[model samples]
Target: MRVHVVGTGLIGTSLGLALTRHGDEVTLEDAIPTHAALARDLGAGRLPTAGEEPDPELVVVAAPPDVVARCVLGALVRFPEAAVTDVASVKGTVLAAVRAAGGDTTRYCGSHPMAGRERSGAVAGRHDLFDGRAWVLTPTPDTRPEVTARVAEVARATGAAVREVPPDVHDRAVAAVSHVPQLAASLVAARLEDLDEDAVALAGQGLRDVTRIAASDPHLWTQILAGNARAVRAVLTGLADDLTAVVAALAALEAGDDAPGARGTIARTIAAGNAGQARIPGKHGGASTVYETVRVLVPDEPGQLGRLFADVGEIGANIEEFHLDHGLGQDFGVAEVDVVPAAAAALAEGLAGRGWRIHG
Candidate 1:
């Protein structure tokens, strides 16, 4: 396939790299001169140029939310022979914008690769960015079968799982999964930023985990969340309701009133979270995920982490990952181990029986 990708940032550049490796001819285009030059240097481009006759099998628009539709619509108009797709996170608005601009609907499809990094730009592009991730294609009734197949072929070149969904459905799902989570992480980190030096000194892995996505570029998130405000608001409404319940439960626990009621409320909330979390698909959609965090107190010394790993090894279950929560105030930090849902319960039980203080 001879492919042309516009907006040579992380997504476009990554796709260029993947397509090139799969023996497809790739040409990268970007509004920024440096980005185009960088893509060429990084081998994700044949070089971006304007006013050239666009001849390609597929054209992927990997632009920012604000300009994605305009760019893709322009590409489709100029290259009627090629199938066009976009990797914009927000879909409904982008697709509408293209329609409003009189783009070629039969040859264009809205797509989004459910993968990214805190970083952006052609320089930050990686060849394996979309490997084993889900890439959704939102095609309209007017879309031709050949165009749809070509878009799927491009997705497969990146080693992504191709799924078809309506644009509206994709927008709502991303609002819940991606956009809202970014805001949540940012809020967590922002609250910590307001803390005093001494208070922040007690920061641990749990806080870090919640706030890691906060390191993402604020400008990009601003565009994303604002572009899909209604969907994002719907997701936040649900989150606000859940938070209200959790707060009430904590308040009851603190006041030491209605012990049974508080326990029941907290248990139900935790169970709901666990159940919802288990539905998150694993790598390549191979399995459903259940991450049970088993907290173990580890001494703050050399080889202590290694010993914990060995101890976890003795439990005879696979450890998917481990998190270290540390503090200067305590001599020991908590290690949260992640295992499969089936293995999590037994791993926790077996480790606890061996004198390990494990938490769920």
Candidate 2:
């Protein structure tokens, strides 16, 4: 497959690297000449030499959300015989823009690769970024079947699982799953801005996990949120209502009102969160499974984690999830290892017998 990737940023460069590794002939291009040269240097793909006119079988427009439609349209015009696809996270807006611009709808399909790191640029791109990730194809009624198939084939070649959904459906789904969560994380993280050092020092693994995506590029995310404004606003509106109720309940408690339902309101809110968290897909996109957690005290030193992992492997216990947290002013950390309920007891016993301190 001859694939031409436009905009050699993280997704574009990563796709180029993956496709090139899969033996596809990928060509690199970007608005910034240095970015394209950097991607080519990183073994993503090659750049066109002088007097060379390269025609691609597929043109992947991996531009930012704001310019994705324009890039897709340009690709369709530049390579009339090739199928064109854009990897913008927001699909509905791009599709509408292309349609309004009189682009060839049959040869253009919008796609979203549900994979990214908090980092950006070609330097942060990895060939395996899309491994086992979902790549959604949002095709309109006029999209040629062959065009969709061609894009799916290339996506699968990068080890992504392909799924099809309507553009509006894709936007709504991501608003809840991706966009809203980013906003929530950012909102929560914003509260820590004015905190004193003492208050911030008490941060734990929970805070780290919550604020991880808060490190995302604000410029990029702003474009994404604006592109899918309607869907994001709908989800945020529901979230605002829930937050208002929680705040009112807290205020009732603070005023010593002894409100009969205040506690119940808080309890229900937390319970609802638990239910939603539990419904999240488990490892490898499987149905959620309950696992018992085994907490161990790990010394804060080199090679301790590797030894623990080796011991766990020796015990023949499959780890379903894992988390590590360091205590404030302590020389050790807690390693929370989650395994099947049946394996928890034996794994704990094995680790304890090997001079490991097992925390309850």
Candidate 3:
């Protein structure tokens, strides 16, 4: 398949790299000539030759959310025989804009690959970026079946799992799962900005996990949030209401220990979070299973982590989850290894027998 990727940003360049690696012919383009050259130089794909009118079977418009419609329209016009798709985060806005501009809806399908890094630009492109990730196809009624199939074919070529849904459903789903979480991460990280160095220094892995996506590009996120404003605001309104209740409960508890229903409210809030977290799919998108955690005290030195991993392999315990956390002012870190309930005891015993300290 000959694929033309426009906008040579992170997604576009990454798609080009992935497709090219999959043995498909990929052509690179961007609004900036230098950016396209950079992606090509990184082995993503070749650029168009001078005075050569290149033809592609599929055109991927990986432009930012705000200008995705315009780029998609241009691709549709420029390659009349090609199936067009855009990799913009928001789908409904792009679809609506394309329809309003009288673009070719039948030949167009909007898709969002549910994979990206916090970094932007062609330099951050990775060939394996979409591996095992969800590539959602939001095809409208007018979209031809072959058009959708072509997009899905290339998406799978990059090792992404293709999922089909309506454009409106895609917008609402991402608003909850992706957009709102970004805002939450950014808001939580913002609190650390005004804190004292000592307070910030006391941060743990939990804080780091919650605020990991806070480093996302602000300008790009601004456009995404703005494009999906209605759905995002709806989710945020519910979140705000829940936060209000929590604050009220905290205020009551601050006034007195025996405040009516205050403890119940807080407990319920935490319990609700626990339930939600447990519902998240386990490895390989399998059903969620409760795993028993075996904590080990790891010495702060090189090769300690590698040795621990090798020991776990020798112990025949399959680790389901692993986290390393450092204690404040401590010379050692805690390694939390989660395994099946039946394997946890053996893992703990085996590590202890190997001269490792097993923490409770």
Candidate 4:
């Protein structure tokens, strides 16, 4: 397929790279010449020459949220014969703009791929970024069925799992799942700005996981949050109310009164959090699976990790997940290998028989 990608940022360049890797012809463009040049140099795609007519089968507008609709409209006008799609995170606002523009709707679809890094720009693009990730397509009532199929084909070509949803539903869902979480991460990370070095040094993996997305490009997030302000504000309001309740409960507990319902309030809040977290889908888009951990002492050497994996493979125990925590100032680390409950005992015993220390 011949494709044209606009905006040369992480999403656009990544799409170009992925499409090109699959033997598709891709042309890249950006508002900034240097950006487009960088994407081209990175083997994402080639830049079209002046007055070169782009007779593409699909045109992907990968602009920021604020200008996504405009980019989509421009692509539609330029490639009147091509199917057009945009990968902006905020769908409702972009759809509203496209509707207001009064452009032909039959060939346009708004899509968003739920994949990204904390970094931005063409230089940060990865061909495999969208692999096995959800790519949402928002097609209005007037969108032609064939046009929608074409957009879905583009998504699938990049190894994404395509999902069809309405613009409003996509906006609200992302506000709760993506936008609000980014804000929460940034808010938590902001509190560490003025903390003492010793206090910061005590941070663990949990803190790293929570604040990881806080490193995203602020300018882009600003535009996205502004575009979806209504939905994001609603989620934030509910979260604020919960925060108020938690704060009040903590204050009451500080006063040494098993005050009316204070303890229960705290417990209920924590329980609710756990319930919500457990509902999140796990690997391969299934409900979270319960796995038991088997801790093994791993010597801090290059081949030690490989040997551990080889040993686990030899035992035929499928590792669901693993984490290695280094023992401070020691020459060994703890490798917590998670497996199905049924495999836990056998894995532990097998490793113990092989001269490996089983912590638990």
Tell me, what's the RMSD of every candidate?
4.5, 1.4, 1.7, 1.8
CA error at residue 288 for candidate 3, angstroms: 1.8
Output the number of the TM-score-best candidate: 2
The deviation in Å at residue 62 for candidate 4 is 1.1
Which ranges of candidate 3 are over 4 A from the true structure?
Answer: 255-258
* Clashing pairs in model 3, backbone N/Cα/C closer than 3 A: none
Off by over 4 Å in 2: none
lDDT of 1 by residue, 155-211 (tens): 998999899999999999989888999899988888976789989887766777888
lDDT of 2 at 307: 98
Tens digits of per-residue lDDT, candidate 4, 281-313, equal 866788898889999999888998898889999
TM-score order of candidates, best first?
2, 3, 4, 1
Model 2, span 1-360: residue lDDT tens: 999999999999999999999999999899999999999999999999987867998999998888888999999888999999999999999999899999999998899999998889999999999999999999999999999999999999999999999999999999999999999999999999999999998898889999989998999999999999999999999989989999999999998978779999889999999999999998888899999999999999999999999999999999999999888889999999999999999999999999999997
**Displacement of the residue 305 alpha carbon in candidate 2, Å:** 1.6
Residue lDDT tens for model 3, 116-153: 98788999999999999999999999999999999999
Clashing residue pairs in candidate 2 are: none
Clashes of each: 0, 0, 0, 0
Evaluate all candidate structures by whole-model CA lDDT and list the values in order.
0.85, 0.95, 0.94, 0.91
In model 1, what are the clashing residue pairs, if there are any? none
Q: How accurate is candidate 3 locally (lDDT)?
A: 0.94
Worst 10 residues of 1 by lDDT: 282-291
